[model samples]
Target: MLTGQQYKDSLKDGRKVYFQGELIEDLETVPALAAPLNEVASGYDKYFNADPDAINPVTMAPMSAADLRDRIPVITEMDLLTNTTYQSLMTLSVAAARLEAHVPEVVPRIRAYVEQARKDDIRITECITDAKGNRSLAPSKQEDPDSYVRVVERRPDGVVIRGAKLHISAAAFGHDLMVMPTKAMKPGEEDYSIAACIPANSPGVHMTNTTYHPTGRDPRDFPVSSHRSIPDSMVIFDDVFVPAERIFLDGQTAHAAVFAHSLGLWERLGGVSFMVEQADELVGLASLIAEANGTAKISHVREKIDEMMIHATLLRAGLEAALAHANSTPEGYFYPDDMYTNVTKYQGASQFNTMVKHLHDIAGGAVVTAPSMLDFDNPELRPYLEKYMSTGSTVSGEYRTKLFHAIRDTTADSFGGWHFVTNLQSGGGLFAQRLVTRKNYDLERARALALKAAGLSGA
Candidate 1:
């Protein structure tokens, strides 16, 4: 496995990456990209630095059944969530193994790419969403064929692809990309049914980055945003050639559908795993700010806290339920209960706005109008600001300001706004989650129960 510095140095390859209309010559040199790059690198470091007992024998990395079984925090405390990056690698690894059980035509090649990824210890960002020009139309029916990423040229040795993939997180930082069909393909949409692993800096591959972090803020003021920011990108493939061995599924529509199903299961479970931590942090912050404001004893304040706690608790339960009911594929990869995973993700996304509302209620206006960290540092304003900001006598004025700033950065500011949207849209959004839930729900059992209750014959 590569060291953190080795991972950082790997991005020096001449990939065409653009940010805010300007070309980025090197990712490590860019401030906005560097944080997430470092974040990804830390995963490699964890594997290299971990004690032998922490390692998972199957993946040859430092994650465990307990780490996942316990549903440990992934967002709030960076040090504790040791297997965050390995989870992504494992998702695709298990995906390849699972796909092998059903799609024999493509499994061999897919397995080859999976083996290479494991052997090289490649850090991969899964790229599934294509830039569809029109939502109402299918890929083949779109006004432009480029709406969906497709193979334009099939060569004896490889295939050439041209199109764009959007909302690919950590695309510019990772070593490799695992491309899959965004959705199931129809009979005529064979060209869009391609899944392959391409080097991030492969020739003709370009990326334009998007981030939520505001520039030039004191790290103390925008603590969360300033410290770690993961940027998404629109990865364009302009006649990029992919070797035959790297291609997983080429013009296989039936298999492509299975890939989407399997990818969603793994991706949603991963999202659910990480988001439980976000909920935990939010709950803690809400309770902390309420106490800092000296309103913890108020009945209404307690009720609001209860609401947030309920959301957090229910989410945790759903995650555990999914894990407890995990199903193993014939290939030996265990997947979370599909219904439970989708329900957990949907519940989390649907309640995000309400959760933020509860947070805003508990935090009050202080979340938005809190004095800047710079103001607190000013010699003249320090005492005055402290006097006005101070609450709950025991809570230091500076500490109160920091808590409010944390609230603002995470719940009310632009960075917080990004979190809101990301929560809703991440892991394929509410509609997708609902669709999966509906598909997996046990409707027949419900129908029989209802019929028996109505004094009708149970069919």
Candidate 2:
């Protein structure tokens, strides 16, 4: 495994990464991208260097239910790049299992790739959502042929792909890009059914990056996002070549959905786990702000806090349920229960906005309009601001201001906006989660119970 410094040095490869219309020659030098890059680099050093013989939980394949449960804390603390690498490997493993019975030829390639990735200890980002030309038309029916990433030429050695993937998180930083079909494909859409692992610096691959990291602001003011922000990229593949060995799926239209479904399972599981923690944090913020504001005892405020507590608890319960009912592939790889995972992800995402609203309502206008930390630095103004901003001796103006800063940084600013959208859209959105939930739900059992209650046996 590479050390932190080595990891940073690795990105010096000729990857075309753009930020704000300027092509970034070195990611480490760009302040906006540096924090996350350093974070991921440090993660590598922390996990791999701490114990060479010990298995890093980020890359460890869960073999049993206990293993799945044990990975929660690690997953929660993992950087976005590390977590996505885990998701990529797990997606491939699950997809391979699903295709083993039919497209057995691809299984070995996937397994080999997973082994090599783990051995190399490289970061990978998933590229699934395409720059689709039309929402209503299928990939083959789109007016523009490059609407979805498809195989443009099939050479004896490999295939050449052309198109773009949007909203791909950390695409510019990762070592490899896991490309797969965004949705299921039919017979005529074979060209679009291609799935492959392309190197980040591969020829013709370009990434235009965007980030939520605060620019030209006091880091203290952005407590949540100041030191941690992952860049999302519009990754364009202008006829990128993929070696045959790296192509996991090619023209296998029937099994195209397998990668997507498998990825959704792991993604939702990770999403729910993270949401459980985030929900608790939200509750803590609400409670803390209420206390700082001296409104903790108010009936309505207490009720809102109560609701927030319940939300956090339910999300935790969903995570536990998902773990307890973990499913195993034929090859003995364990993944979280789809039903519980999707339901919890859906519940958490669908209600995320309301939770934030309660937080904002409780936090009041200070969340957005709080005096800057720099204001407190001004000796002349400090006294006046403190005199008016403080509620009492216990809640100093500085303390209260810091609290407001945290609230604003997390829920009222750029990072907050990113959370609001990603919470709903990540892991394939609410509709995808709902569909998975319905598909995995035990409706037959509910029907049986209903029939028994109505005394209509075999009606």
Candidate 3:
């Protein structure tokens, strides 16, 4: 396994990464990329350096309910790249199993790839969302056929693909890119049904990156995001070649959706797990700020805290159910229950804004308009501001202001905006979650129960 320093050194392998229109020659030197890079590097040193004889829990296949349950805390604490790497491996495992009966030839290839990735201990980021030129049209019907990544040439050794994937997180930093079909494909759309694992530094691959890390601000003022932020990339493949061994799916339109659905299942499981953690964190923030504001004893403030506590509990219950009812593949790899995972993800995402709203209502305008920490450093102004800002002896002005800073940094600023959108859009949007929930729901059982409730049973 690579160490933290080794991981940072490996990115010097000539990957083309751009930030703010300037090609970044070294990611470690870029201010915006430094925090996330360090985050992944630290994760490698922390998790992958255990005893060589023991199985690395991050990549281990869950064999039972306890195994699945045990992964929750790790998943919640994992960095973005590490978590995505887990999702990538699990997606391949699930897809390979689903394809065993239909396309047995790909099974061994996938298993081999997974094993090699584990041995190498390299980070991988998934590239699934396409440029998707027109939302109303299919891949082949778009004005630019390259809107969706597709195979343009098939050589004896490999295939060449051309297109772009949008909103790929940490694409510029990972060692490999897991490319797959964004949606199901029809018969004539075989060229677009391509899935492969390509090197991040492969020729013709380029990434334009963007991040939410605060620029030119006091780190204390932006505590939550200043310490960590993942960069999203527009990963472009300009006729990138994929060796035969690296290609997991090619021209198999029938099984294209299998990769997408498989990825969705794992991704949503991770999303739901993170949501459970974030829900609790938000509750803690709400409670802490209320106390600092001396509103903890107010009935309405207590009610709002009560509501947030319930939200956190429900989300936790959903995650528990997903693990307890885990489903196993034919090969004995266990995954979270799809119905519970999707339903919980949907409920958490749909209600996220409302939860934030409740937090904001309790926090008041100070969340956005709070004085900067630097102001407290001013010798002359500090005394006056402290005198007015403090509620009593227990709550100093700086103490209360720090809580406001946390709230603003997490929910009212750039990082907050990123959280809001990602909470809804990541692991597919709320619509996608709804579709999966509907598909997995036991409607037949519900119908039977309804019939029994009415007087129409056996009629």
State the C-alpha lDDT per candidate: 0.77, 0.90, 0.90
Could you tell me every candidate's TM-score relative to the true structure?
0.91, 0.96, 0.96
Clashing pairs counted in every model: 0, 0, 0
**Comparing 1 and 2 on TM-score, the stronger one:** 2
Which candidate would rank higher by lDDT, 1 or 3?
3
The TM-score, computed over Cα atoms with residue i paired to residue i, of candidate 3 is: 0.96
In candidate 1, list every pair of residues with a backbone clash. none
Q: Write the per-residue lDDT of candidate 2 for residues 76-101, one digit (tens) a residue.
A: 98898999999999999889889989
RMSD of candidate 1 to the truth, in angstroms, is 3.1
- Residue 358 CA error for candidate 2 (Å)? 1.1
Name model 1 segments beyond 4 Å from true: 49-105, 457-459
Q: State residue 248's C-alpha deviation in candidate 3, in Å.
A: 0.8
Error of 2 at 373 (Å): 0.9
lDDT by residue (tens digit), candidate 1, 1-459: 567788678778888888888889877677787767777678667656344234323243223345445333442344212232344555555556666666666666665666666666666777888998999999999999999999999999999999999998878776777788898898988889998889989999989889877667788988888867888889999999999888878897876766666666456766787678788888999899898999999998899889989999999999999888877655455667888988998898889789889888988898888889899889999999889888847988899889988988887888888888888898788888888778878898898889999898645
Task: Compose the digit string of candidate 3's lDDT tens values, residues 289-401.
Answer: 89988899999999998999999999999988988888888878778998899889988998899999999999889998888889999999899879877889998999888
Candidate 1 at residue 344, lDDT? 90
